[model samples]
Target: MVDFEKEAIIENLSKVINTKLTEKANKFVTADVREFGFIGDGLVSDTAAVQKALDYCESLGGGEVIFPKKQKVKLSKAGYRSIWTWNTKTKLNRAYALLIPSNVTVNFNECELIANNEGADVINLIENKNASVDLTKDSNIEIKNVTINQSIDIDTFAYNSMDSCAVCFQNIDGLVLDNVKVLNTYGYGMRIIKASNIEFRNKIQIDKCLGCNIRLGWQTFIVDKVNINLLVCSDSSNRLTANAVQGNTLHMNACSDFVIKEFRQTTSNPNKYVGSVNINNNCSNVYLGKVYSIDTGFKIQDYSSDGSNQPYNIVIEDMYTEGILDRPLFYIMGEGTKINNLRCKNIGHFWINNGKYTQFGRAILEKSSFVVKGNLPKEVHFDKLYLYNSSAAFQSNGGQDVVTIKDLTIKWDETTNTGSYLKLLDIQCKFMNIGSIVHKLEGSMKDGGNQKGGILSCSTENTLTKIGNIIDQNGVKTENVVVTLSTGMSTMINLAASNIWRDSWLNVLDVELVPVDLTSSIVIYNSFIADTNGQSLKINHSKAKGMEQFRLIVKGYKHIKE
Candidate 1:
C-alpha cells in the first residue's frame, strides 16, 4: 500500500509546478500567417497579406504570429536592392515590408522565409525613416526558428527599409532573435541601428552576403548593453571579383559597451579574407570572449573625420586563431585595450597596435607556437607569455615611455628559421625594467647553426658580440651581434637567471662580472661611456637589490640629444 500523506504532498507539488508552466504556454493570441492570407507558395507576392497579419497582431496589444511549416516565400517589390529614389518613376513602399513592431512574438516553425521579396528585406522591424533613431525600454519583439532567404543578386536587390539590410532593426529597445539563418542576401544579412539592452543568442548563422553579415550601430547611432554570441559567419570564398569591401563577418561601427561571446568565423580560403571582423569608429568598453578566426581575427580602429574618434576600454580574452592570413590576429588602433589567453600558430602578425595610450597590458598568453614582431611600448603589463618555436619577439626600441615587462618566456624550436633572439637596442632613451625572462635555445653549437641574435653598436654600426652568443649555432663562435643592454643609467638591471645555455651566462646583468667575446677573449667594459668626448653622466652602484624595488629617475638634464 502507498503512503497516503507522502503521495498527497507529491501530488500537490506537481500541481503547483504545472500551474506555473501553464502560464508560459502561448501567452499571446496565436494565429497562423495563412489565416490572414499568406499563401507561402514561393511565387505570389504575399507581402500585403502577411503585413496585414502583423498589423493585426500588433493591434491585439502583443500576440503571436506563426508561419506555417514547409513555407516557401517569394514576395516581389519594385527596385529590390536599389538606392532610395523618391521620384514618381520608382515609388518605394516600406510599409508593405514584413515588419514586426513592438510587443509581438513570431514563430517560424522551422519554415523558410524565402528570398522572393524584391526592393526591401523580406522582414523588417520598427523602421526608422531617418538616419537617427530614438529608443526606450518599454517595447520588445521576439523571433525564433526562422530562415530569412534573400536569394537575389545585386542586380535585383534594392536598398529597402531604413537600412539596406535584409533583416533590419531601428530604435529597438528589446529584441530576441534565436535560431535564425540569413542566406544569400544581396546586401547585409542583418542591420541594427540605435538599439539598447538587446540580446541575440542561440545559433545565429549567416552565409554569403554582398556586405557585412551583420552591421551593428551606425556611426550616428547611440548604442549600448548589447550581448551577441554563438554567431557563425562564413564567406564561402565565393565572392565575385566585383565585390566591394569583401563583406566583414560582423561590423560594429561606432558602438559602445557591448559584449560578444562564442563568435567563430571562417573563410573558405585562408588567403581570401575580405575584412573579416571590424569593430571600429569610437567603440568603447567592449569585451570579446571565446572568439576564433581563420582570416583577420579583429580590426579595431576609429576613422572619424579629423581623426578625433578613437576606440578605448576594450578587452578580449580566450581567442584561439590559426593566426591571420593577411592581417594581424588583433589589430588595435585604440587606447586602453587588454588581451588575455591568446593562442595562435604560424600565420601572420599576432598583434599590431598602432595607437597611443597611457598604459597597455596583456595577460596570460598560453599554448601558442609562432613567431611575431612588434614594438614594445611603455608601461606594458604582461604576465606569463609562454612562446614555443618563437622566431622573433618584440623589438625593444626606446620610446618616450619606459617599458617594464612583468614576465616573458621563450621556448625555442630547432626547426625554427632562426632570427635575432633578442633585440634590445641601445638607442633606448628611457629605462626598461623587465621582471623575469626565460629563454630556452635548442640545437648543437657546432656546424654554424643558431647563427642569429644580432646586437649592433650605435657608434661603429658593426656587429658587437661583447656578450658572447648566448646560444650555440654550430660550435663555431658566432659573429652575429649579441645583446647590448647599455642604457642611460648604470646599475639598472636586476635579473635572476633561470635555465640557460652554459657557463657563458656569467655576465648577464653584472657590473663586476666581465663580458666575454665569442670569437676572441676580449673583455668588454662592465659599464661603457656614451660618447668619445667623455661628456657623459656616470653613476656608481652602492647597493644590490631586485627589480621589485628598482627605480631610475632622470630629471632636469642639460643638453638634449641631437
Candidate 2:
C-alpha cells in the first residue's frame, strides 16, 4: 500500500499495452490506414487493401487484420465494382477464420462495409465462371457475430439493380454461421449451391430483404438451434411477396438423408397467395420435425417421368398446420410416402390424391403393410386404417383392392349444403367393417324429392364378407343407405350385427339378381329385420345361387305391405 510509484507504473502499463492485449484476445481488429502505409482513408477505398491485408496475414503464416473502431470506411468506386470480382477463378484462400489453429475472427464493430454507389451488389461468389468460396478444403470455417448493413436509398425511376448478395456460397462445404445478421439486402439470404456438410446456428435475421429467406440446392446441410424472423412488413403491395416462392424453407432437389430439426418461421402477414413448403423432383429420405406453419403447410409431389419407384422413402412426423379460410393443411401426391403423427387444426381442405392408377390413395398392403389414419376431405383408398370425421370417412374408387376401416366417424353440418354421410364406390375388399354415426346430414328424407343419405356402391366381382352396424338416432330414416353388389358370380353379403332403430328401414336392394339365380344357392343370414309398418325388404335384380338359405329373423314388425 505504501509503494505508490510501483502502483502508478503498473497502472500505466495496463492502460497502454494490457488493454490492447485484451482487445486483441477478444478478436477485435481495428483498421489503421497509416500503419498499412495508405495516403488516407480515401486512397484505400477499394478491396485491394483489404485483400492485401488478408494476403499479408496469410503470408505471415496466419493472423488477423484489424479495422479501426468507429471509422466510416467508404469503399472506392473501383473497390465496390471489384469486390464481386475478387479471385474470380478460385475461392479466397485468406480463410477469414479457420479451424486447425482455432482460426481467426475479423470483427467489424462501429465500422461499416458499404458499396461505393447505390444499386451495386456488395458481394458475389460465382462458380466455374468466377472464383468460388470452397469451404470443403477445410474442416471448420466460421462466420459469426458480424453485421452487414447495406444502404437501400436509391432513385425509384433509375433501373439500378442493387443486390446485397449476388451469389452466396457456391460449392462450399463444412461452413458455420452463427449470430450473423443481414440488414437491407435485395437478393437471397444465403444461396447455397452444391455444398454439403454445413451448420447454421444462432440468430440469422434478414430485415427488409426483397428475396427468398434461404435456398439450398441439392446439398446436405444440418441447421440446428436457429431462430428466423423475416418481417416483410412493407406498405407497398408488390413488396409483400412470398417468403419462399420457388423453393422451401430448406428445399432439396434429388438430395437424400437429411435431418432438419426445431426450425421456426413467422411473419406478420404472410403472402398467403403462395405455398409455404414444396418438396419436388425425386427427393427422398427426408426427416422433418416440429415444422409449424401459419398458412398452407407442406406439399410433396413425385413428378417422375415413368412415375414408378421415384421419390421413395419419405417420413414426416410431429407437424402442426394452421391456415385461414381457404388453405389446405397438407397436400400429398406421390408414391411410397409415409406420414405419421400429424396434428392439424383450422384447415380448409385435406387431400391425398393418387399419383398412380394402382395407387389411387391406397394406404395398406395385405396385412404386411402400414396403416393410414387421420381426417381427410377427399377419398382415401388405403390398405388398413383407423380414420375419423367429415361427410365421407373413406371412399375407394379402385375396385378389387383389400381395405379395412375401423372406428369410422362421419360428421356433417346441416347448415352447409354438402351431400352424403359416406360414399364407398367400386370397392372389393376381402373384409369390410364400417362403424358410422352420422352427426348431421344436409336434407332429411321427410322433406323428400332428393333422398340424400350414406351409400356403399360396389362395382366389382368379389364379395363383401362383413358389414358393421349403423348407430343413428333417426334409425336409418334420413335417407336410404344404398349397398349395391355387382353381379355375374355368387357373392355373399353378410350382416354380422344389426342395431336397426324403431323407425328405421333397412332396405337391401340387390342388383342383377334373377328369379332362378336367387332360388339357387345365395345366403344372407343372422340379420334382424325390424319393421312395425310393413316396409318391404326389397332384394331385387340378382343372378346368384342360394337365396333360400337367406334367413331373415323378423321381430316386432307387421306383415309386408304391397
Candidate 3:
C-alpha cells in the first residue's frame, strides 16, 4: 500500500509540468504585416506599415515577420536618414527602406516588392547605432522567398550612392538569403560586404541589373566562408542599354574560402556587356564548379586600391563558352589556377599574366583557338588538347621557365577548312618539352602548304626537346652552296654567317659534290673534302680537270651549349 501511494504522487507532478510548457510555447508568436495597417493593393505605399511590423516582431524576442500570401508591397520613396554606412574609411551614406534586426526571419511568403526610381536599398541587414558601424554587432538573420523589382525612369533616376541595391548585407554573421529573385534593379542586385558565415541557397536569379548582378566584398575587409548553390544572371532581350560601365554578372573582391556551384552568365547580344565574372584583389581558396558563359569573358585581376594583393589557389571545373569573338576567354593575373575540361566554340584567345603554376587539362576548341600573350607565367602545363580547324593552336610570347604540352592533336576537315594553312606551334621559351603531336587531316590536305610543311618553330636559350621524330625547323643545320673550282683552289666560308650555325657547334655528317657544268670533265679522286676547324668551313679542290662549277651540300646537326 505504501509503494502504490508513491507512484500516484509522481504522476500528479508530471501533469503540472506539462501544462506550464504548453503555455510557454504559445508565447512564440508570428506577426503579420496586414494586422499593422498594411494594404495588399499594388497602388498604395506599404513601406511604413512593413517597417512597423518588423519592429514589433523584434521587440517580442525575435519571431517571423510574415506578409500576406502573394501580396504586392509598393515602396515609393525613402526617408532621408543615414542608418548605415558603406565602409569605415569611405563611410558613404546609405538609406534603407527596411532594416532587419537580429535573430529574426522575414518570410515574404512568395510576395513581390516593387520599388520606385529612388536611391535606396530595399533591405539592409545591419542597423548602425550611431555614426559608426560594427562588424560583430548582429547575428542570425534570414530573408527568404522575396522577389524585388526596381522601376527606373531613366531620365529622373540619378546615380547617387554606391550601396543602393535591392538587398544589402554588411558586417553580419550567420546570415542566409534563400529563394531570392531580383529584376531590373537600378544599381546592383545584391551587395554583400564584410560578412562571414553566409549562405545563398535555393536558386538566386538576377536579371538585367544596371551594375554588377552580385557584388561581394571590396578592398577594406575580407569576406569569408560563403557557399552559393546556383545563380543565373541573364539578359534575355538585350534591354540593358543605358548602364554606365559596370555590367559584369558577378564581381568578387578580397574573398576567401568560397565554394560556388553551377553559375551561368548569358546574354542574347554580347556587345551589350563587358565581361561575365570578375574575381579581383586578394581572393584565395575559391573553387567554382560547372560554369557556363555565353558571349562573355572571365577576368581575374589585381585592381586593388594599393595594388598589393593577388589571388591564388583557385580551381575551376567543367567550363563551356561560346560567342566570345572580341577578347580572350580568360585573362588571369593570379597564381596557382588550374582549369579542368574546357570546351569552347567561336573565336577567342587565352592569356595569362605573370602567373605561376597554372595548368590546363583536356581542352577541345572547335573553330576557336588558344593564345597566350602578355607577361608569361612562370610554369604552365597542358595535357590532351584537341584543336579542330583552328587558325592557330599556340602563338605564345614572353619567357617561361618550364612549359610542357602532352598529346596535342590538330585536326582539319574539308567542310570547315578555308584553304588556309594552320600554324601549329610558335613559342620562345627557356625550356620546352613536347610529348607527341598528331595531325588528323582529310580531303585536300596537303603535306606542304604555305609554311612549307613546317609544323614546329621554337627558339629556346637553354634546352628544347621533342619526343620521337619531331624536329625544330628553326635549328636545322643544312646548307647547300655552289662554288667555282679551279685546278688547285681553296676557299674559306664563315660558318657564323649562317643563322642556324651562329651559336651552334657544327658536326658534319655527310658531304656531296655535284657538277653544275656537265660539259667539263670531273675527277672524283682529286676533289678534296670539306672540313670545319671550329670557326669556319674550308673547301679545297686539288686536281680538278678544268674550271668546272660544282655544287656542295653539307648536312649536319647542331649542338647548343649545355
Best by lDDT: 3
Off by over 4 Å in 2: 1-117, 120-139, 146-167, 181-187, 203-211, 218-248, 270-275, 353-407, 418-498, 501-562
Q: List runs of model 3 lying over 4 Å from the truth.
A: 1-28, 83-88, 118-132, 153-162, 236-245, 304-308, 324-328, 391-398, 414-422, 442-454, 459-465, 468-562
Q: Rank the candidates by lDDT, best first.
A: 3, 1, 2
User: Against the true structure, candidate 1 has what lDDT?
Assistant: 0.51
Query: Model 2 over residues 138-168: C-alpha lDDT tens digits?
Result: 2223455545544443112222233334225
lDDT of 3 by residue, 1-562 (tens): 0011222223442353234222321123588998998997878888888878777867886677898898888876545444344455555655556777766778898988877444344333223212224534555677789887766432244554445667777766656778988877655777777776676779888886666778888777567677778888875221343545366788899897777777898875566554468888888777777889887777777664333576776777788877655453666666667778878777476656555556778877776756654444367677877777554433335554566778777666534344454454554555555565666554344443333222444454434433322222333444555655555556455654532232122223234567776643353523333343445555564565456666656433232324
Clashes of 2: 26
- Give the local distance difference test score of model 3: 0.61
Among the numbered candidates, top TM-score falls to 3
Better of 2 and 3 by TM-score: 3
lDDT of 3 at 551: 68
Model 2 TM-score (2 dp)? 0.53
TM-score of each: 0.66, 0.53, 0.72
